[model samples]
Target: MTDQSAAPDATPRPLDHLAAMGAPDALALVDRAGALSFTGLDRAVGALARALDGRGLAKGARVASWLAKTRLASLLPLACARAELVHVPINPLLKRGQVAHILQDSGASLLIAGAGRSGTLEAGDRPADCALLIEDEAGAASLAAQDGLPASAADPDALAAILYTSGSTGRPKGVMLSHANLWLGAVSVAHYLRLTADDRTLAVLPFSFDYGQNQLLSSWAAGACVYPLDYLTARDVIRAVDKHEITTLAGVPPLWVQLAEADWPEATAGRLRRITNSGGRLPVPLVHRLRQLFPAADLYSMYGLTEAFRSTYLDPALIDTHPDSIGGAIPFAEVMLVRPDGGLAATGEPGELVHAGPLVAQGYWQDAERTALRFRPAPVFSKYGGMAVWSGDTAVMDADGLLRFVGRDDEMIKTSGNRVSPTEVEEAAVATGAAAEAVAIGVPDDRLGEAILLVVRGDPAGEGALRDGLKRDLPNFMQPREIRWRADLPRNANGKVDRAGLKAELTS
Candidate 1:
């Protein structure tokens, strides 16, 4: 782990602090059309912040944005942070019910939505007191015409944003993040990544995601430019990289898979200095292929969740020998493996990963019971009764202290009374040329209580041979009872495997 003292104190407020960046004329944001310099972005954010405040909304009130990756949506977070209001970004793809749920849950006094998305809010019955601001010509003219208002001074502990999780099990829960929490997270990531003012980051992930949002904040903190690309195809990514001279890009495994197969321009790829992966681990084969493609860029395999933002990251240098390892605790965090009995696990022992330090979130919004279950005190040490996120992820540490992810605790399949990691099954399946991707689930069985079922995407003709090969790799009990091949596995909006959807398919 890097020494904390060596880390730079890069925390700054979203509004005024960022405006003071040394090179204000440097590009800060880039869209398909053009780029916004630091000075230009600050002016726009200030105008928006004033416009939001002039509408009679008080400090600490919620302001929701339901739009695509437009310049306004990109600026709203910082603008809201400046006004001391919590910004809630609704996923544009969400249905009316989901959008309404977020609006109600956040208690947003006002909503700033694009014309298309505004209908979702307008059609739904909302609180009578709530005001709506449509992001249209009229709204833009209104904002442009409005006079400036004083910036709201915010404490570091004030609520900055309320990001909603996917809520695969139930209703999405809002994750409360303070300015301090976000600032610290950004600083931690920036310090470890060694971000600089010359860096240009291509933003592909949704701003609603914690990891995605950090790409903007950390880059801004380092006075770097962020090109927000709402790409329709892999070609869009390839084009944007070359067009903007992009240096950094963050993506999930699915995006990486797509990019790896896409016809990438050598000139465009040559400009990228860094590429990051999270949401899920990049398959070892895919990681190697990416390394081969972008020989000049540093490939970062990171592991994180909304609850803690980011936990571990495998350095680019170690990708060859430890492709499976998720690496160690990032700057400002201490990650440990705790056994089921609440003791620290020995080296190479699998246990729940407990993340301690300032990076832990306040808790799940309005769900104290669930919050208590996950966030608890640090068992190994306590300086200020600090809370640790008891991540449901199972991990093992090697002698050198690098952590390898085993599986999610809830995702562990029990077959014949033995716990098995679905990821292990999936990894083995993907290793064979027969499958491009795989997911394993334990289905109900009269004899064994549960039986393993495999869902795969591959050539149908080779699936039979792949099943035989899987049996050879796995034990008799661990071998899947059923093998179903699909053209492609179902993915959620964030591009993660929709296990719930997969399970539904099995029952249907």
Candidate 2:
């Protein structure tokens, strides 16, 4: 792995990642509107930045987008950075309530959505001060545009984006990211992955995800092309790879499984130079199958959290000998395993994973209590000392200093590449009056890393209503795989429902 070292005095903003890129006429982005060259990409970002600044919002205003993966949607991150605004991209799969919480929590001054999406918001869902614009009507049209702003530079540490992620409990919290964090992250990944201008990355993941956002950022940093696709099925992704001659692909374990199940032309599969997995572990058997299918492609197994952006990625060469290991720290990150008392863990001993470095996020937005809990002072042994993300995940470092994930210490359920909050799901169910008492737990599944199994003490006759309500209110990933009703739920000594007891019983 390349050791990342960024000098103290010089730091770049997010937009600087794309500045001075090679070959202005080379392809940079491809979407429904058609392909955009490096020149076109710069013009698009400049035009969008101009339009956003003309809205009369303050320089540090929060701008959110809830549109699907379109040309404009794909370019908003860069545009927002150029305008000195914090961009918040919401997952299109999120329901109206989820979108509302993000806007209100981030205090977004403007939101851009499609015309049909505006009516989806119910009363009180939108903040009073927030302005809405139909993206199609906003019309980012121009081939010759330049940044008219003065040569004044932006602060690298200024907040650039607020990415909302479902915590272990309560509502989803926003993770604050600075310009340097993003620019360095892009540099780190692009350097390690050896991306080049000839590579074409097929961006299939949602922009809200940190890993997904990098698909655009890293490619731009390497002066490569990114083809964003909003695929409805696994077949759509397979066809796109052949059609676009995609060379780089990133996915979670669940998505990798879905793509594996679909039939692929050998020639098309060979076109992929590298594929990556994060969010969840890939079973050893599946890893073998992927290697067999894509003989020419390298497979990267990674582990990350939103607070730190990324932690470790196992090199492709180690997949056969150490398929279970999460490898060592990525560039610009310091990964350490700490004991219960905050001391360093001995080799082969399990401890909490702590990440410290420039890649670490600023913290939770406007919520100091939660931020203080997760983002604490770095371990005494850390080389990059400051604030570090104390990830509540248990892991062990091998003698070679490689980390192998043991288990999660938190109760968050990871399903289909999405982190789900158990409490949030239960609260929504109770609000629908489907249950008086509820306990949400994650059950082991073959496909999804963890499938939600909701147990409630309510009328069995309300099953139909509960299902319908959840379908309407929750995202597809957050929906429970099965609903079971009981007369009583076990309680711990504190008098709260025992989610641990339910998970143990169900999984056993």
Candidate 3:
């Protein structure tokens, strides 16, 4: 066990992260609009902060942004923190129901969104008190505003952002991140990845993702410029990389597969200095193909949960030799494999991957019941000596102290580099009135990593209604690849849906 809290919490506030790096004239950000220098980005952040502060929001009030990867969306995270508010970034891909849930659960006082998305919300979709602001130049604060606030001197452990992610059997929970968590995580990833000012990162993932948000924060920490892209196709990514001369790229497994098979000019493929993977494990064959295609770039395979931000990451040097490992503990993180007896697992023994340290998130927002179930005091053997995130993920540490991916303790379905709750899908399926009983199952798919197979105990004719209803209620990723209709469904001893039995039958 490493000394998790050996150093006191001296981490800088997230807003100050901007002021410390990047010279005034150096390039800082690139978007569809144009490039902005470090000085220009700093001023924009300050102006946005001043505008948000001018609003009559109380300190620590929840300020949510549900727009695309626009300039306002990009600047809101740090801007909210500087104004002593918590930012809740809703995934733009989510529909109205999911958006409404977040607004109600987070008690968001204000929502800034584009008309395209804001129009999707009807009647009760928005909370009674949640005010709305347009996302354009006149709607919210514009980039050309003035009176930017200086770097903040706020508490390092105060809430900075609330990132909502799905759990195994419940509605999406908002993972509360503090300034220290975000700062230390950025510094750790930048140091391990050896980021530098000259590096250019093409951020293709959503800012709502923990790892995705880190791309911006970590790049800023290293004084590197960031190019944020919201792409609809793989070719868009290729074009962006070529246009921006990007050095860093981060994606999940499903995307890696697409890129590996993508036709890239030799020069374009070699431009990447580093590629990082999260969201899911990469197949060995996929890893080999990536190595063959981008031999010059370092590949990092990382594993993390929202509760802790991140845990283990494979060293680029060991990728070929030990391709399956999730590596060991990251900086400021002490990852331990604890057996059922609350004792540390011996080498080669399966145990839950428990992460202890400052990088741990504060916990889910306003859900004390679930919070206690996930966040608890560290084991008596812990050196961190505080609450640790019991990941509920099983893994085995090799004698070399390297950890390998095992399985999740729950039936959470991971598809397209995002975690999906089977319960949410089942609930939506039944809500369509297409099924008397519904069971959402995740089956292995070479393309999607895992394809959703929704089984329903309803009329075969109801399949159309089921698919259409799910389309409205759930995101595309949550839609079932196949809907299996049955006259009757299996049941457990307690007479509830036997999910284990269904999964067993399908896999068997």
Candidate 4:
């Protein structure tokens, strides 16, 4: 890991750095608003910042965006940063109640949304104290003629954005990120991904997610172009790759499973240089299939949490040898496996993953109880003394220094007086080639205390065949007691399978 304590000078700020990358007319983003150049992006952000300031929002006040992935939506964060305001991006897929919760919870001073989306909000949805600005009305030409926002004493340590969690378990809590947290994360990812000016990345993930938001930052940091896409199917992704000659793409495991099954044209397949995975582990069988499909493209298996933008990434070169490992720490991050006794775990022993470094976020926005539980002091032996994210994820470090994921501490299933990782069971089910996706949950059972419930989405005809395969592959206690087939599993806004939701539904 690079020196996290070292601070980078921020006189021009990150937004200006993108525009000053030599070619002002070079493309920065492509969307319905047309091809926006670096200079155009800089000016557009400035115009919006001025508009927000003119509308009477105090410096550091929260400005939330609840629109789709439009050009204006892409510019909101930069605009908020320039105005020294805290940006809160709400997932467009959220319902009325969820949107209301965020608006009231953040106590935002203003909200910028599309005309169509703005009409969807009821009186109860947004606070009476907060103002609303229609994005379609905030055009570049009109806003540019107005006065620009006055400079402020904004520093790197100031809070930049508040990203809300998926809230599968409870009400969504905002994850606070500082300007330094975002800036350093962008620099680290761009350096390690080897992003160059020639690279054209497709941004399909929601910007509300830290992983998705980094797509824009990392691409712009490298002077590369990003194409914003709200794709509906695997075909759309393939078409975008061919249309924009996209070199880099990032996706969750569920999306990858769908894309892997799509029929890729030779030209579309050749344009892709790299694909990164997170949100969940990529099954070994799917990894082999991706290699066969995209022989020229590099595959990066990564592991991360919202608290820390990213933690580890397995290098493309080691994909075959270490498919199960989450790799070592990424740039600017130090990942340690701490045992239950609050000490470092020995080699091959599973321990909680603790992330310590600059990338650790500022913690939850207003939930101190939750924040204190996840974000705590660094380990006793650490070189740093500040707070570290105590990620509840369990992992084991091998002799080669690569970290392999076990499962979440709370998600571990107890069966027959033994602890079982749902990931292990799910991996085995997917390897049988009888299911496209699998999730194993433990429900109440008097005999076993908790029994395995294997849920899958695949051809119904193959269920018996998969059961036979599982019988041979798994021991008695680890075997799932029942198998249920569904047309499709429910996915949250982040594209991850809604495990908590599924469990609640089963119990209810």
The predicted structure with the larger TM-score, 2 or 3, is 3
Per-candidate Cα lDDT values, in order, are 0.77, 0.86, 0.87, 0.80
RMSD to true structure for each model, in Å: 10.6, 2.5, 2.8, 10.6
For candidate 4, write residues 99-211 as lDDT tens digits. 77889999998887777767877887889998887776544344453555533446878898999873323456899998888877887787778777888999988898888
Cα-based TM-score, every candidate: 0.79, 0.96, 0.97, 0.79
Model 4 weakest 10-residue run by lDDT: 1-10
TM-score of 2: 0.96
Candidate 1 stretches with Cα past 4 Å from truth are 1-6, 10-16, 121-125, 145-152, 382-385, 411-508
Model 1: per-residue Cα lDDT at residue 367: 84
Cα deviation of 256 in candidate 2 (Å)? 0.7
Off by over 4 Å in 4: 1-22, 137-153, 167-169, 411-508
**Which 10 successive residues of model 2 have the least lDDT summed?**
1-10
Which stretches in model 3 have alpha-carbon errors above 4 Å? 1-10, 140-144
Better of 1 and 3 by TM-score: 3
Error of 1 at 432 (Å): 38
How high a TM-score does candidate 1 get?
A: 0.79
